[model samples]
Target: MIQLNTKRQFVYFIAVVLVIILGLASRKYSNFLPTFLAENAGDTLWAMMVYFGFRLLFVGKRILTAVSLSFLFSFGIEFSQLYQADWINQLRATILGALILGKGFLLVDLIRYTVGIVLAAFLDKLSLKYNN
Candidate 1:
């Protein structure tokens, strides 16, 4: 694996921060995001895009591994919501909230995970070709 330089590290840091911010923003204020959030299918599909896009931008892991991690993380978070953390749950009910804090668990979320991971993998390859 190539060791990231200072610039790359900075980019990575920013990328990670953006990912977190977007994730949080999506959770806390879904209405502020895109038109897709108002629609269930669009929201799920966009979530997959964000998940995969983050993985693509991240440089610390192998493509497949990174994508898999993203998929697992998404799945875990959605599944964990079944426990119903009041504050988190309430937040998820919002437009952005729903994006991050999904409304409980749905089998379709697994499909979203798969789509996200695959997109991440594809984007990772694209990044390698163009950015590496």
Candidate 2:
């Protein structure tokens, strides 16, 4: 098991919060960024946030396990967009809903999510290696 002590878990939680803030900022101020980056940053950060969130919760899991779970959850959320109902749409219209469920589905999002989770896994491994 990949166990992190209380202090490390708290740190992971803080990182998740910071990433969420940055992801939101990226969306809000996207017009200021270059077009390519502006378009993709939010999606990528969304996956990264999921990875960190999983890391925070599954502190005893391996990095690859966390990454895999994050990818699956992100993909599931993306796929959930295909279902459209008034009630669900209304929920999707809300801020939290939009943030979690997303507005639509894109094949490229799967790739972006994979990239984000892979990067997160790499960073996780690096952190473990350096800290040990």
Candidate 3:
């Protein structure tokens, strides 16, 4: 197994948790952010999904694993909004907030996640040229 250091594992852990929280908050704060961002929060969160997915995949796994987790994390957040909490949803009201707090979940977000994955994968390939 690939053993990540405490800090690395923590970073990954926090990333997942934070996104989940943001996803939940975004739904509650439906009135918090811009219409454009609010409408496409799925895409923005998908980018985070993309980033982490790529990061994990870079470490070596079947592409499906990263893709599955990416969709799971993103879609999971979209699903959580049905509960409607206060503090969590409050995050959707700000600029970055809307990015975190989604407006609402939709099947379309899955498409965005797919696009984000492709985009991230492309960026990952591009990064290889310079990151070394």
Candidate 4:
């Protein structure tokens, strides 16, 4: 049976919150950042947030599992953009939906999500190795 590590889950939850704050800040004050970085950072951070969220929920799972699930979820949301119903688009127009669902599909966003998940997984593994 898998054990629940409350400490680790709490840490992951905190990290997710931090990432969300950073992501929102990046979007709000993007003018401060270079155009290239600002354009991609929010999406990348969103992927990281997803990764940490999965980590928080599945505390004892392997990092690969969490990362894979994050990627699948992120990619699913991105591809879902292909469907543009009036109701769905209206939802996407809101702050929460805009943040989660995004405005449109971009192939580059997939690459950003992949990079974010891989980097998060690598860092997660490193943290686990060193903490132990």
Can you write out model 1's per-residue Cα lDDT over 70-115, one digit (the tens) per residue?
Answer: 7667778778878886777778879767756667787876776676
Query: After TM-score superposition, what is the CA distance of residue 54 in candidate 4 from its true location, in Å?
Result: 0.3
lDDT of 2 by residue, 21-70 (tens): 98899989999999988988889888988999999998888887898899
Local accuracy of candidate 4 as per-residue lDDT tens digits, 1-132: 434468788778888999899999999999999998899889999999999999988888989889889989999999999999999999999999998899899999999999888878888888898988
Best lDDT among the predictions, by candidate number: 4
**How close is every model to the real structure, measured as TM-score?**
0.56, 0.92, 0.48, 0.94
Regions of model 4 farther than 4 Å from truth: 1-5
Q: Give candidate 1's whole-model lDDT.
A: 0.61
Clashing residue pairs in candidate 3 (N, C-alpha, C atoms within 3 angstroms): 25-88, 25-89, 26-101, 26-102, 29-89, 32-93
Model 2 worst lDDT window (10 residues): 1-10
Q: What is the C-alpha RMSD of each candidate to the true structure, in Å?
A: 5.9, 3.2, 7.8, 3.1
What are the Cα lDDT values of the candidates? 0.61, 0.87, 0.60, 0.90
Quote the lDDT for 22 in model 3. Answer: 67
Provide the clashing-pair count of each candidate structure. 7, 0, 6, 0
Worst 10 residues of 3 by lDDT: 53-62
Q: Mind giving the per-residue lDDT tens digits that candidate 3 earns over 1-132?
A: 546654534455556566556655666675897876577664755556545644653445544566567667666766765656687677766667666556666777667666766655565455545655
> Ten residues in a row with the worst lDDT in model 1?
38-47
**Which residue pairs clash within candidate 4?**
none
